[model samples]
Target: MYTMNRTATTEMEVTSIRLERDLKDRLKDLAGNQGYQALIRDVLWNYVQQKSGDYQPQLSPEEIRASVEATAQTEERCVLTGKLIRPQERMLLGLTKSGEMVPLSVESLAR
Candidate 1:
């Protein structure tokens, strides 16, 4: 049996924070340099979220597992050998005979 943590459902969490006056000024300048007139919490949050798996889309373990399984089952077969591929879900491929994988954009293939 398994249960989901209620707090883990969101990408954003709130807590009281303190900033030194000079640091606050620097942050505000950084925000303004980006063309926003005021500091946005999301921007700071994004900095904190880098590579922490805290800013990913919401998908439960079962759903993710199911998606992976489905992708495996429907892998685009390599035209050369008829072997199943770990499909590049967003792009087409050109399998060179030298066993090198080349990515081809849909637009280029359509032309």
Candidate 2:
């Protein structure tokens, strides 16, 4: 998940590579469905991850929910209660220090 730093005036590397006609057409079709540049970046990133074995493991919905629950206590705060959340409560109904319920993101649950 590499994102460009907007605060820093850094120039990124840009390269032009040639692709076969068939491949290009297929990519273009996918690009039509997704975004051309985004699709290209995703493909390249996936390839790099595969080669380096740096890909993140896929989490099942249950595991994801559990992880979200476990991590909620660390940093996430209930939007309404302004209190830190806990694992036992549903994210949408998370308790704040004030005893209010709220929602949270999945990333906020990760260690």
Candidate 3:
């Protein structure tokens, strides 16, 4: 949910943290050309934004590849509208263009 600001890197402060060798290797593999350090920063920023209530996950209609009807087994928040979905409630699972599954209210896509 967080967008990276590549130009802001020059203002970043150096900080050191320890990581398990296996975890480091996995991050490296996942990061690929972007490099593990930049990926770590993105992961951390997303976590912080989500926890701070500043991150609102949303997708335009074009970004949603498909939607499937589903029943929520647990409470969920609609990614598009931020509406709360109760457990066992009928909902839609929107498959994003990037292949992420996100919760949606039944009326979210209603015409």
Candidate 4:
């Protein structure tokens, strides 16, 4: 998961990109106080991390606000345990505190 690094200072290079007016407006609305540019960066970073296989799935029950039963339409890795969930297997879509819906093994929620 991509987290905002508030204390870390890193050099940034400016780049220009064009977006549709409607999309820009939506991003602005979703970003709120964080700003759309930062949101875009976060989205991009998440994509890169996932594609690069650098994402470590580590989540606690406390970080999950709720969960919904689901069946995997495709293979997925549990965000809480890094367990492989095969296609058509029982799983869960956990609603995290950050508002992301992440895959979880069915047993991950067992208490």
Candidate 5:
């Protein structure tokens, strides 16, 4: 007979995780009856909470605009292919170094 852990009762999708044998054993021991999935979830949740608490405020609109203008004036590259893209060049087609046509955003080019 096979039974799933308690999280299966929720609408969340099921996923598999692969861990080293020793690490798995340690987590299972720490998890006790809760199962390794619950323990891993708790560990990930704590990490996210701790990390998200350190966020900084966004730049002001004027500062953002200035930065974008400065970046646009400077040499820019395609984000995906990292090839140099000139300011006057037709942005959409001329950018891809790999020759794959990808969407290029004006805001992205400014940065």
Candidate 6:
């Protein structure tokens, strides 16, 4: 999930490595069906970017969704009204009269 900040916005990466003949064939076979090179570049760049960022955990969509859902359930216990908020939405709003409000996505927010 490492996307480049490029203008055109197509995933791109450059690499210098060697693949064995058999592996190359396998890749070619896969390429015909699945853009193998495109995938390889994306995966390789993901590793590179992740490492560059100190190995942040790459959470899947399901994980994020589940986390958000859990937070929403907990938040529901507190009040019956007020729009459900997402973590990103709260972050975008910043702090109110208090200070920096803890950022939470409606699915993930606890309160």
The lDDT for every candidate, in the order shown, is 0.39, 0.48, 0.83, 0.85, 0.47, 0.41
Candidate 6 regions with alpha-carbon error over 4 angstroms: 1-17, 29-34, 54-111
Name every residue pair that clashes in candidate 3: none
Look at candidate 3 and tell me the lDDT of residue 6. Answer: 82
Question: Candidate 6 has what TM-score?
Answer: 0.33
Per-model TM against the reference: 0.25, 0.39, 0.70, 0.72, 0.39, 0.33
Model 2's lDDT to the true fold?
Answer: 0.48
Write the residue-wise lDDT of candidate 6 on 1-111 in tens digits. 344443332543456778888987877786676466655666677667544643333332222222212232232111111234433232212232333233233433333
lDDT tens per residue, model 5, 3-92: 224455467777888899999999999889978877887677645533555222212222221112222333444433344546654343
- Pick the TM-score winner: 4
Ranked candidates, highest lDDT first: 4, 3, 2, 5, 6, 1
- Report the C-alpha lDDT of model 3 over 1-111, residue by residue, as the tens digit: 555668566688989999999999999999999889988988888777655666666566678789999999997777777677889999999999898998899998877
Q: Write down the RMSD of candidate 5 (Cα, Å).
A: 16.0
Residue-level lDDT of model 2, residues 1-111, one tens digit each, is 222223322454667888888988888887786556667776777557535645443222222222223344444443323344455544543344444343554344445
Model 5, backbone clash pairs (residues 3+ apart or across chains), number: 0
Kindly give the stretch of ten consecutive residues in candidate 6 with the minimal lDDT sum: 73-82
Residue 104, model 6: Cα distance from true site in angstroms = 20
Query: Model 2, stretches more than 4 Å misplaced?
Result: 1-11, 59-111
Residue range 17-54, candidate 4, lDDT tens digits: 99999999999999999889888988888777666767
Query: Of 1 and 5, which scores higher on TM-score?
Result: 5
Error of 2 at 102 (Å): 36
Question: Candidate 6, 51: how far from true, in Å?
Answer: 1.3
Poorest stretch of ten by lDDT in candidate 3: 49-58
